[model samples]
Target: MVRLRVLFASCWCFVAAASFSQGDTSLIRAAVLEQWVRALSHDSMQGRMSGSSGAQKAALWIATAFRQIKLKPLSPKKSMILPATVETGRLRVRINNVVGVIPGTDPSAPAVYFTAHYDHVGVGSAFSESFPKFAPFHKKTDKDSIFNGANDNASGIAGLLSLARYFFSAPRLPNTLVFAAFDGEEFDNLGSSAYVGQQEPGKVKLVLNLEMLGRARMDSSLGHFPIVTYSRDDKWVIDSLNKYYRIAFGDTSRTKYFLPDPYPERQLYERSDNYIFALEGIPANGIMMTNDQDLYYHHPADEWQTLDYGLMELVLRRIALTVYQWLKASGGS
Candidate 1:
């Protein structure tokens, strides 16, 4: 553990970046994404099950990163830790959501959120129902019990932190940026369910939840170009962003850079924390790169080592740039 902390400290140096002049994506470089994902999905984290020691550790780590990035806490407790309860039928467990704010000059500024749940199916037996839909892929004969969840959500959390850091360094926009590392997203969106009922109902402009972006999309023919989930009304948003992305990045390929959710039958959008916010009648959506096509979706093999850090870096940069552009334009066409 001591050695792990030491390595993490060294990796964190790249986080601050020796120079901020390069670009917005500098802090979110592939190496930095690897470091964040590695630390979050390390065996030492014990799969980050909600209410477990690992989850607590992860929460503290996120709050620390937010603090280091100078993001203000949303809580009056003078901390970034926001508490919630996860209800599992008969049992209730207390968990926490780590939230931070990059305030706009106006107190009335609409809030734009970047979120990802940080919990997984913890240490479970080979037969554990951690992933029921994909249970057929489980290797019951295998001895691995830890559900590292590298892509299931460690990647999302890494993306979350990276965006927070990027916005912290960028010039202020019309909206306040809120980065939330939610807990208990597994076990049926327990954390998100509790959070959507906050003080102000409609103060939200958009919630871009990052989930499972460390790999290529196996569910769609659209390839691995990053994608978002939204209903029919918001399809134009994706198309508009695609046009902007090509012109802004000089992407000549006709391949669409953004696509809508591919697995409506599997309820991919509802499975993520973003859905609960949408239930409250807010403009909330999620960005993801893979679905059930991921062979290791919930398997023990879903470790940090299996992830493509390069792909993840691209995912982060594209989504960060798009979201930032949206914020700057004040949710325009």
Candidate 2:
């Protein structure tokens, strides 16, 4: 196992030494992101199936990482792990959704959330091809039983951890920042549903769900760009809410690129954890890097090596910079 104490302390020191700078998000490190994804998506984690041993292992690691990050726990009983049970008519099994918070200056203000799922379709499960295109080269991959969900959602977890590392050390905001890694997203996105049921919906200031951020291809030749999924009305609300950042994400150009739901026909906005939060009137959206048409999407080929770590770093830094700018403009920084 990687040394969490030493590594996290080094990370903390790296942040502590630097003065907080608005619009300066050099804090995001590709190495750190790589480490996170490598650990979470390692084959031994066994695809992190909900309520499975692999899922439990991943949860424990995330919870420990949260503790190392010094985040306040939301659950009093279970600490950072949001204790919940899934009842499948005949079988009810326990699952943990990891939640940690960076408290803000004002305790009463609505909270901002960073969310992603830590579950995926495990091995031995037959999955019909939605749109299958086998990766041109198997190269060195084991293409066997293990469904290592590296890009499916492990990338999201990596991004969330990077965000936590950045925002935790930055200047304090007026509202709390909650980082939540949910369970059972592959099971019809039910984990977030349970979480949403537990929280007061109106108290959520905003929800930014990170999903599939590792391998991004505008096309085969082109580099990475970001896309966020949100309902039409909620889109406006989110854009208005993040107006302070001057990101101009809604109004895109050739250079400043951000896609507005490329797969509207797929109803992607209603798919991930953000949908559950949005249903409760929370201003929520998911920041995804892919168009979801790729060989390694849910396939066994979706290993850690397939991800574009450099592009992932770039996208995450952009997000951090925007959030920093927003926090500065909001008068809490």
Candidate 3:
């Protein structure tokens, strides 16, 4: 018995050492999230509404971050700038989508795409204006003020940047990785729609759309998870994600599920940028904390202070690792 125990201990020690050795590359951390949210959600960005100066500034910042991370531009000459115009009544506003690419070592490998929208609801009626009876104390000062949108989407953009930085700095990836910061997601997903129109569906293997990952609530009930989500016709993706969620989070209760359906808040899956890619038959999915019922959503109170940075970092790291695993399994370029 003593000899057997000794042998088991030795094997355990070897396994632990191997796991440690695999940690040579650092995982996505909270500090990176902090830096990204701070910059993207700064008041100077002015809510980053599509076709607004704030959105343009945010685009420039995202492009700069991609450059700093050494990601090659997928567009011609390593850069792509797509211009779009939206007519809002008497106003005709123009917006642009920023795209970059990291070439994979395997020329024949498929491409994995990561996307996030940087736009949000611009300054508008205060929460109280819509709900005078339930107005909070801070509503008076925050009404009609710039919505910093720290959590609404800046968090997702931060995750996108962190993922890009990781892949750019790490050894050559097997599949081509495309990073896109979409504009006009809040309005009608115009940016992503335009992108889908230009590219062939066969080139994209997966689209991981990040959205509203800043806020963290205490609810662990899978029932609280977002409903009325959308994906491509591929059952493989749904099965894979369902398995991973059950194993990683340990929740196996299957709740009622369906494709995008019109709701009070509109069918969110069809409303966001991911819908554009999904329409093209790409296996696309979105990550978000809001269940479409958060009171602070799109409100001025949606500031950085309300975000759970720790949870945000965890989600981001998990997403990054999951993407890596999926690419490896899918034979991505």
Best by lDDT: 1
Candidate 3 lDDT by residue in tens digits, 12-91: 99987754432212546777787888788888888887777888889899889888877777756545555677554455
Per-model lDDT: 0.77, 0.74, 0.69
- Kindly list the per-residue Cα lDDT of model 1 for residues 1-333, writing each as its tens digit: 999999999878776453232236667888988899998998888888887898898888888888888889875565688787766766677888888888876567778888999888777642245446435444432788788989989999999888888877777776778888899887788887777654343578777888988888443555555565544345666776677677556689986778787667877877788888878777777788878667888777899888888888887887777666656656322
Q: How much does each candidate deviate from the true structure in C-alpha RMSD?
A: 8.6, 8.1, 6.2
> In candidate 2, what are the lDDT values of residues 240-259, reduced to their tens digit?
43453345233343443344
Q: Which ten residues in a row have the lowest lDDT in candidate 2?
A: 127-136
Q: Give per-residue lDDT, candidate 2, residue 327.
A: 57
What is the C-alpha local distance difference test score of candidate 3? 0.69
The clash tally of candidate 3 reads: 4
Candidate 1: misplaced stretches above 4 Å?
Answer: 1-23, 75-78, 126-141, 198-201, 217-232, 250-255, 331-333
Lowest lDDT sum, 10 consecutive residues, model 3, at 255-264
